[model samples]
Target: MNATAQPLVRFRGVGKSYDGVTPVVEGLDLDIQEGEFLSLLGPSGSGKTTCLMMLAGFESPSKGEIWLGDTLLNTTPPHKRNIGMVFQNYALFPHMSVAENVAYPLTVRRVDRAAKAEAVKRALDMVRMNEFADRLPKSLSGGQQQRIALARALVFNPRLVLMDEPLGALDKRLREHMQIELKDLHRTLGLTFVYVTHDQSEALTMSDRVAVFDNGRIQQIDRVDSLYETPSNGVVANFVGDNNVFVGRLISVQDGRAEVGLPDGERIFGQMVGAARVGDTVRACVRPERMTLCTRSGFDGGTPSLNTMHARTAGTLYFGDHVRVRFAVNQQEGGFVKVPLDDESLTEWSAGDELMLKFDERHLRIFA
Candidate 1:
């Protein structure tokens, strides 16, 4: 997104509380760019759903302000917000036909018959559910009903769409298929989307940017790649993907990098995150895919072993396309290296094999 682009939605110091004393969402300030897919992702009770509810006007904010374009939305009712919503249970009326369900929003707005019919047709076509216009929602399969719900949300031409785990009820394969479909639809329609989900993989797969929430606070908000590759903290690193983390004392901090000392007196270097003192006990993290497993010979004379560590193979597990080799670094089994199936040379290792784990210094991240 362009930095200069004006945000279509803004949350300034937004907070939510049901019991008056405890907050579910706290001091949130976020700007969502127009036509971008932004996901509120976190575990349950982490305040992501509350944020969505506040924006959708289903729940009022206890403090702060929410703006849609230039309009203040704190006191606006849901129907007047011009925002479409889709939920996990499909929320379809069993008595209403698909077309009728899709036309409900337009009906509430008193749209003329001809225009409502045209919009209903276009929305059905967008979701490829034109043939099911006459079918009752109860007769439709889970995926079909989800499509109809989506079409209904779009039929009225809402300014923004909010989805809260709309695919949670579907089977795994169907859910994956819908993720792709939703992303493609978002790109084609170019509409602002705010999604709330607890599944990290689902958020990563569908969102252009993700706002990670925990304990009623947004820990980090950034592009998906940045969130995964360079997470802002330990919570995000562990939540977004497979991260190998170890506790170490910060030995030195120079320029943006740091030298860390392990309990066994071995030292490694990496880029430092946040500020840290020389003696501060810090966390060092690296992704599983970034570690390279090599035998002793591979790191001898030619390789100077700048970012190398001595590790013993704890175990190796196979997962169809790739194998994960767990390593005991400094007598602690914490790090792992992922090896592709086609790499035969790296697969013939036993649990007790003495090996070396090498990685680029830039791949390591130190968190204070």
Candidate 2:
């Protein structure tokens, strides 16, 4: 990390409310590094968009303050924030060609004619849309239109850029392709990006850090890998990925492990990741890929160090590259285990087969 990577944006105890009641964002405290790509990710009405709107100066905070470097932006107007913005709908002018759309912001700021043309050309080339510069937005594909929108946002060379579900309108494949392009662009531009999205995969794929929000509050903020491996709570764990949960009560704790007793008399040991105490009600999370179908006795210590339970194979669903194995355990609601299609463990496995559901203990996460 360089010394120049100081925080470019800070939200200190920031909050927002519509009618002086029921705040949309409550007590938000975050520091965005100078060029880091940070994302506000959550479901609809989770305050993710509200946070971005506040930062963009489109909405006011009911309490606390927002800081850009050393300047307080509470009274600053949208254009005065000097931040670029991209909306979900692209928001390009219908009659404007790609070049004109890209140059709009610069024109509004009274940029010189020669400089505006040069900047617009550079921005279009950056987005790989220079060839379509003469085409109107309606004449371009969805992805092309989105590229124009992105170009417009960058043409001004703003220090910070805010994107609100910018790829939401594109198809799934195009969205994924754009995610790679945007991530590469972020690295090359070295501009601070404040991305807001409800898609967990989108956030995980593009963000250097992700802040998970729910109920108008930030539940957890961490790197993508860390957030998936050790979630702060059940809500975050369940929200981020495909997770299998087990409801149980902690019976004992020792050596950083918790012995949890499930609905049945079966007791399984799990690594305590979240807040869990003996005799406390808790939920355990395990990723599907970490689980395996155990039928042969040849496996003794191959599994991860965390939670294991006895389960019977109930059914299976084939998904081309992988298969989902559904099973039942101790008369309790059970979950699925996803494995590669060519795994040898599935050779003899069939529906109704009795087997031990194997999962790494280290991957087991307990949340209270």
Candidate 3:
């Protein structure tokens, strides 16, 4: 992002409501920078897809304004907005050959024959689908079909590209392969890309920034590392990634840190996310990977500012690269600690064993 350039797209108090009563998207004020890969991420029916549709001009905003560069887009038709859209279903022409499908955008715009052919060839080559140009849509694999859709979207060289779960139909390996390709193409072409997906991993993999949406609103928007590491509230923390939440009351607060009392009467300390006085209810949020685990022999783990708990091991699930160990802290269950395969747990630990779990105060996030 540059220091002081105008945003490529802006939404100011923008809202959408089909019934003129309830809003699917309400009071959305967002900015999309030029040449950045931004992803709108959330769970189903969280207004992410509706926001994308509004920006693509498929759905109109019932209130407020949308701007592309300097022009207001309230009355602009879909084609006149000059935005390329790639959908979840690919939306390809099944009867057309690959080359013909890629050239459809050019045909609609009435580009000259020679220029349209050259553009179609370049777009197909860019997606590595030029060799399959003569094949019908059904003959290609899911990944190849996705590539053709991408080429068609890129053929006319639109101002911005919008993708709504474009890789949702492919297998896991193929989807990962396409993620890398899309990221590479974004870097090579230096064009603005706005993507929508419910997959947080995909958003983190491809986006320079992510807008996390929930209940018809944006909870937070920030860089991936910042959003994951320092979430603004409990909603953002629990939604963006794997988080273990402990309900507790504020026993005391000192210098932006809080001493919390859990249900079991144990006291622990963590960084307070916001201002809270004594005796206020709060939550302790911790990522599984941020915790440290040790056997009974190796832990004296209690201190004034550090958090330590006695947990009895229940079971372990292997994930090839990492192992997730589930345990019960006192009578409560659903606590997980992730460790690498080479950790001592593979050979030295088993179910029904007592382990001490400790974490630094910096890794524990407190929210009210």
lDDT of 1 by residue, 1-368 (tens): 56587899999999999999999999999999989999999999999999998999989999999999999999999999999999878899999999999999999999999999999999999999999999999899999999999999899889999999999999999999999999999999999999999999999999999999999999999999999999988888878888777788999998988999988888888889888899999888889998877787666622432577788888888898899998887745467889998897665688878888777778888999
TM-score of each: 0.95, 0.95, 0.96
Off by over 4 Å in 2: 1-5, 296-306
Candidate 3 TM-score, C-alpha based:
0.96
User: Clashes in candidate 1: how many?
Assistant: 0
Q: Which residue pairs of candidate 3 clash?
A: none
Q: Is 1 or 3 the stronger prediction by lDDT? A: 1
lDDT, candidate 1, at 346:
63
Clashing pairs in 2: 304-360, 304-361, 305-361, 306-361, 306-362
Q: Put down candidate 3 lDDT per residue, 65-162, tens digits, no spaces.
A: 99999989989998888899999999989999999999998888889999999999999999998899999999999999999999998988988999
Winner by lDDT between candidate 2 and candidate 1: 1
Q: What lDDT does each candidate get?
A: 0.90, 0.87, 0.89
| Span of 10 residues, lowest total lDDT, candidate 2 | 298-307
The TM-score leader among the candidates is 3
Stretches of candidate 1 off by over 4 Å are: 301-305, 331-333
